[model samples]
Target: MPEAKETVLEIDLGALAHNYRYLRAKIDDGVKFLSVVKAFAYGNDSVIIARKLEELGTDYFAVAYVEEGIHLRKNGITKPILVLHPQFTHFEDIIEHCLEPNLYSEKILRSFVETAEAKNQKNYPVHIKLNTGLNRLGFDHPEIGTVKEIISSTSSLKIASVFSHLAASEDWKERDFTVGQIDLFRKMTWELIADLDYEPILHICNTSGVINYPKSAFSMVRSGIGLYGYGNDKNIDPELRPISTLKTIISQIRSLDKGDTVGYNRAFKVEKPTRIATLPLGHADGINRIYGKGKAGVFINGQYAPIAGNVCMDIIMVDVTNISCEEGDEVIVFGGPQHPVKFAEAGGTISYELITGIQRRVSRLVIPE
Candidate 1:
């Protein structure tokens, strides 16, 4: 990999391939693999990641919204793109772009049916989302009859798949809850499937679900974070390689005397003589403000340098008094020896939030396999 001259998110396609293959090996031969590439592929480049996954034989691709799917389509993503949380307003565009929507409610289902009919679409693929335990999106158990009736009443739409989301599949203490969710999903889908003439693909496992619940794999499994090299478990994490490396360079270095404060409101007052290195990224670039004031540190010169003051919009000062580093030295914000999970933990967050929160302003450097 090239040394970072500026703040850049280095995307390792080799790691991506390894992660995909590792996850792929966990499932049965016939089970389909759906890769979730939403939130700009978890704050990495979506198009680049999706293209690589597409080449790697991903059975399907999922995104949070129709626009995300459309973006992939425009960028040569030919695999079936499932829009997980589509709005009624974009029904026309969804159909026009050959993107499928996960209809989770009566209103969305009915609206999509109407739109499909108006567009003269026949048997357009649509996925049914059920609310087993997540309580976020998806139709309830009682709504299954209504869902069936609406779909039964329409020739424009067809059930492509039936799926649900797992709320706490990663936590061992939530094992019973996750299992109950899986059981309920199976029972509900069976009830719905019995009423229909054909069986749509059944899926409920997310990345963690895939690792924890193998029997619940059903017809397919959707993985988001796992493909980005996080299994949500410490034991499994070592088996997967993180695909993104957030790196920045020291913009400037300064020596400060005792009691010398740094950043806005003097949030950091040097207790003694200190050397602070200013990095070119801060809150605006996805380094959360909560990571300021000695919470999180950057890896510099084989050592860790904690943020000395409050994170600014475009800059952050790190105490590098002990590190033998200078201006323009490459710093690992997260990745390599400093994992993103560790960085996120320092700020009381998760890797998902930290990675997905990365701003679009940062330059992306793709490291091909």
Candidate 2:
């Protein structure tokens, strides 16, 4: 809310809107977009993301848990929400909140049907997740008979959508396997309800699938990171601005001698007399200590500055000696033009991890255009 502050996470709603609109424009008319809002919209506040997506006319919202769906429903979100990993124990709460469940295995399928029938809920919307090589969750294609059994026996649960997840849509080396997976899904769905009249919406595309192979963009595309701004494949368009920005200020300025050592285990031994800045942010706020040890850089007065020494739980050291920076100077921890932080290269992890790993400790400040 304040103009400038220490240790803040800035979210650009405009960038979010742009990404949503861009991805939406890419898909065909009949193909709907179900933006994933799980993990607090990848640690950027789900309520805000869900509301924004709804305003952007997103087809649906997907989360990994029932609690997440409840959060959106409580926040006045009446859009179709799919819980990818709905627990059997919370079946009652899910029904109470009118949140749909993705029944993956036989046990979950039977459990959901029984619960819905007992509650006298007819045509209760549900999704059937098939394990199309992901092997994480979802019933295997061979188990289509079980889905048929559930459908034939129960009138309570309705198969609103039958979907699968792509394990490696981004890797071209896995293209053969991805193609096989897609084929398997088609064969399984067709054979599962050959005689039965099952007209559930068919979808099996994640962000990468939506971008690379729009052919599989079936009924809906469940996108998470793309809507958050960084589509793992950066080649999409530079105009898709990263919605999140990490910022902090210099807590202290220490003038180090040429041979001065800094931080735990004396990790940073200065080669030059440097003016190092101690930032008011560190591992505790999701800037992992590994991010230190000369791995990343930050922006100081629109110039680049290298991080010095090991990052601590509450403080990070930046070598701002070349920038003519003074005490209490504003520090931009990447996400900007001068020294943009490449999440993959800097974190040695994927953009998904970098964005989702942002701890709850950091306060999110949303700025809508």
Candidate 3:
């Protein structure tokens, strides 16, 4: 275990396990669980996170693209990897790497079937995405006939699972919509099952869906943000522990007199003798530029050091005028005493964006459980 002396992301596998168990407890014992490790496990090292989840008995893992799954496979991940939005060009790679393709449209379905047939694959596993309401991807309920036709026409493909995404499972106001989505999913899945005479694993719930609609857990559920320790609901947030801490060491602390300007464009003007601490990271490291101009603060010496002026590509200055801090002091941009959700809210964004936006250049240290 090494201290974060520079800009680093400290990932706590202990807290990740706690979140996994916590979410798992919400569903039935027999239900399967899929942990999403896409976007580098939401910017926390995909291979490491998947390994930890695999150790905890995660039934499946999902990534947004084929390369991510291939990366996991290359790193010794043997569990089923679902490419949620795979491209037709990568169908060969998907097969060669044993990564499951999510057939969301007729074109993808037919194309993947052809690729599998060419590769001499038999009963190759594939997940079907249904467009219940999100409308982003997946085939519409009416397209089930086409979906069935495509599958029946090819012996090379097998339906591993049928799933959909909830539009707004976290908001109480959208509860009715979420329920409608769930009901539609149930109706579509059973209808498809009736025609096929065999039931593949059925799932539609995400993190919030698992919490708000446990009864609709189906055969399996997907946990994305929740596994990273965010419930996405205020009431349930207290139970989950944040797993990542973003820390950076102050490069220098400079004194500024009244009327002195700080940072680019003179965005922050000192009213009195102020101490400005410059950090070695900024928007390039995923601290969004929107967080500047006093909107977000970093934790230092048990105090808040407000951001001063505009965020730079590789630097940011924070006003630590009133705090007792020196050069090389550890600053917590997010996590530990401060949560990323707070920073997200301050920046008018979401935690998913804030966390996943973290650049790969930053070191990710896994904290022992």
Global lDDT of model 1: 0.93
TM-score of every model?
0.98, 0.95, 0.98
> Considering TM-score, where higher is better, how would the candidates rank from best to worst?
1, 3, 2
lDDT of 2 at 191: 73
lDDT of each residue in 154-184, candidate 3, tens digit only: 8898899999999999999998999999999
Model 2 off-target regions past 4 Å? 1-3, 237-239, 338-341
Clashing pairs in 3: none
How does model 2 score by TM-score?
0.95
Candidate 2 on 1-369: residue-level lDDT in tens?
A: 343466888888998999988888778998888999999999788998889889889888999999999999999998999999998899999999999999989998888888999999999999988888999998886788878877888789778898999999878899999998889888887776576675788888887788887887878888887887765565764746778887788888989898889999899999988888898887878778767877887888888888888989888888888888777777778576532337447857666766777777888888976
- Least accurate 10 contiguous residues by lDDT in model 3: 190-199
Q: Write the per-residue lDDT of candidate 1 for residues 1-369, one digit (tens) a residue.
A: 889999999999999999999988888899999999999999998999999999999999999998999999999999999999999889999999999999999998889998999999999999999999899999999988888788888788889999999999999999999989999999999988887778899999998988988778999999999999998999999999999999999999999999789999999988889999999998999998999999999999789999988999999999999999999999999999899999999999999999999999999999999
Which scores higher on lDDT, 2 or 3? 3
Which of the two candidates, 1 or 2, achieves a greater lDDT against the reference?
A: 1
Candidate 3 TM-score versus the reference = 0.98
The backbone clash count of each candidate, in order, is 0, 0, 0
